[model samples]
Target chain A: MNIIVCVSQVPDTTTKIAVGADGKTIEKNGVKFILNPYDEYAIEEGLQLREKFGGTVTALTVGNDSSKDILRTALAMGADKAVLISDSGNSDTFGIAHSIAEYAKTVVPDLIILGRQSIDYDSFAMASMVGELLSLPSISMVSSWTINGSSITAERDIEGGKEVIEASLPCVISAQKGLNNPRYPKLPDIMKAKSKPIDAVTGASVPARVTTVSMELPQTQRRGIILNDSEHDITELVRLLHEDAKVI
Target chain B: MKIIVLLEPSGNSIKRSSLESITAARALGATSIHGFMYGGDANSAQIAGEYGLSDIAHTPATEYSSTAAATSLAQFAKSESASAIIVAANAAGKEIAPRVAVKLEAGYIPDCVGLALVNGLIQGTRPVYAGKARIAVSATTAMSVYALRPNVFTARKAENATSVNVRTFTPQLSESDTRVKVTNVIRNEGKLDVLEADIIVSGGRGLKGPENFHLVENLADKLSAAVGASRAVVDAGWRPHGEQVGQTGKTVSPNMYVACGISGAVQHLAGMSSSKVIVAINKDKEAPIFKVADYGIVGDVFDVLPVLSQKIGAVTGK
Candidate 1:
């Protein structure tokens, strides 16, 4: 089994985001970047597949030089190799998808896995686009799975419920959270990853169908109006909801 | 411009979120709103018309299938020359929107909180960096697809009469297109899920144990609200992942969100800060949940939950 896992670098979930002067991006001066939370699941799943099926797991990502941090992290997490499609375009979802599909053509792996969505763009488009480009079956937001021969049985969330699905191999699986607990890299592996060579390739230049016009902060919530344990506060709260907020 | 809105069926009527999508499409300068139902009854068509749909199209769809439906919607949009395709940012929509974008070779923008038409282009503003900032995006295509978040846009009265023309279509499909089928669906019998619920009562680690979640469930039952859990509780195995509400969990924009003993982590807030009214009950006065709550009661969950549930029950006569 040749398993390929796609990952992305994003602002740490805890970072305080600020709009850049350019108005089309975020200020990254003090913000720390980490591997996308969902993509960690995909990388871990790839390693597990390699362990069970006795083949190589390759970690792939697209970004500029700083993205190497995440690729090294993937290497530390037991991936056999790390490939970075270096591009500074901050390309739209379709452009990224085309770039990944361009690289996928070279490897022709048995399985391709990625995050359900990137936290930054969160467009949730790449895996499906690659699947469509390759004419392969694709499943998104998979939380759990079991590989059986060439057929993979997966379970995913669908609105109010969970659905069990089965699809053949040579498919794209977009990992959702709670699939598995990703293992932390041991000190030795972390040290080894620092020495591992990263393969770099130029990303395909596909024009973005969606262009960023600008960015701004969302309306901040005001300080809450805290109510005490008094019955009057509760009664007033109910009245305010009905008369003022109108959300009751 | 012609805008196609995908309306999903719920019971006999269309999903309220789909109506909100239509409402959103209308705001995008749509001259004619085309309602497309994956599968539904006559009642859905009437509901669509009430929500500003000029015409309705019904297509046969398998349970939880997107491939065939996406292929057909692409054909419809092409034939109708739709300027944009709007869909509810719900499970079915998210699952199918990308596929539709791929098939139609159009731009796909998911989780838009706002949209508009400018210079004959569809523009969208979506929350990014976990709701801290919004990205303004303009689709540089003749046709684009978008998924609208629920509970944000208000539905307006349709200018036309209640009656509208409805059409049906059956698209040809190959076995490979629909190789993945939904074999089984697992959910809380008869209860609403957090994503689709108007009211949600969520518990956190402050509840102490899994058994105490009964306090939340009891109140949720009384108020006809869905039961939700914070990441801490869900990670601790106090609740299932399906009930988790946070950045890595689920994004909800419910009418009312009740936080019980939750400290309101940034990740959790990202999932539900869009709720219309927030009510937080926590013993700690410094709990972050209080910062965003529209109404906050600083009290012990063990003492306050029972009283709150009783009060709501009395009001609801449940």
Candidate 2:
């Protein structure tokens, strides 16, 4: 059995997001980057699946030079190998999926796994698009998965409830939260990951359909009005909601 | 211009997000609004008509449950020469919209909150970074696809619009095309989903014990709101994972959000900060939630919740 997990590097969640001088892109200066938190779930799931089924877990990522750290993190997390699609050019979710699908055509993994969505853009489209591009069965927001020979069974969260779906092997799945608890790399594993082979590939073209004009922070709110007055408290609050905020 | 809105069947009726998409489609100067419904349900056709969609295209897709729906919709949109395609930002729509966009090679905007036509091109605003910022994007492609956020737009009755057209489309799907299969479905009993509720009452670690969740649920019942919990509460297993709202959990933008005993960590704030009206009830006066809240009640949640619930009940005689 062969499994591939897709990962991406993004600004750490703690970073104070700010617009660059161009006002269209994120300010990368003095910002720390890490493997997307959601993708860690995919890596862990892939490793566990490999351990149970006896297969190789290959982690893949699409980004520029800084993305190597993410691939290293995956290898450190117990993936057998890592592949990095090094293309600095901006690609939409569709383009990223196309690149991954194209790469998968070569490796032909039995299962392709990815996070439900990237934490940065949160487009939530990669896994589905990859499924469509590769013509593979795909499920999103999957909480639990079980494998029995060539057949796979999983539980997916819907709006109101969960859905039980069964599909054969060689499928694509975007893991949701609580699928499995991801483990941190031990000191020995971290040292071993440094020697693990990381294959770097390039020359992927992304069709551009949408252009981002500018990105800016939302307008700040006014200083909050503290209600120190005791007599007309709730009434003032309701009035503020109705008249001032007009939210009611 | 002909506009096509993909209607996803949510249980027995069309999803509310699809209705919002229709509202946006109409605002784009669409002369004719067509809705494509998979599985050929008559109730779905009727509901589409209520959303001002005059032409209804019904296609029965048994093998291709959700993904095939997108293929069929793309075919319909191409046949109709739709200028724009609109879809709901739900689970199915989230999967299908991008696929359709990629197949059509159209400019796709996911999770848009607002839309308008500018200089004959569709312009959309989407909240990014978990609602910390909004980005306005314009489509450079010939056809534009948009996934509108759920419950953002009210569904209005489209009077005297009864004409429905049902078209049969065979989607191209393969058995090997899907990588993941759903094996079981478990539904929670007796509470509305936090994402769908108009009013949400959420608790955090400050609530302490799992037994004390009744305090939050009791207030939620009185206010007719859904109950949610922070990541801490969910991680501690005090509440179900579905009810967890934070950066790592569900992103909710409700009309009214009530935070009880929640300290409002940045991760938690990212989920509900987009809510229209926020009310915070906490013992700590300096909790970050108060920064974004419209109303702040400085008191213990156990004390404030019951009092508020009783006062609301007495006011409404419930």
lDDT tens readout by residue for model 1, A109-154: 8999999988876677777788877777888899889999999888
What TM-score fits each model?
Answer: 0.95, 0.93
| CAPRI-style quality class for the chain A–B interface of candidate 2 | medium
**Chain B, candidate 2: TM-score:** 0.92
Predicted structure with the largest TM-score when compared to the true one: 1
Each model's lDDT = 0.84, 0.79
The C-alpha stretches of model 1 lying farther than 4 A from their native spots are A221-223, B39-44, B62-64, B170-175
lDDT of 1 by residue, B133-194 (tens): 88878777888999888778777766874677877866666776777667777876886889
Model 1 chain A worst lDDT window (10 residues): A233-242
Best by DockQ: 1
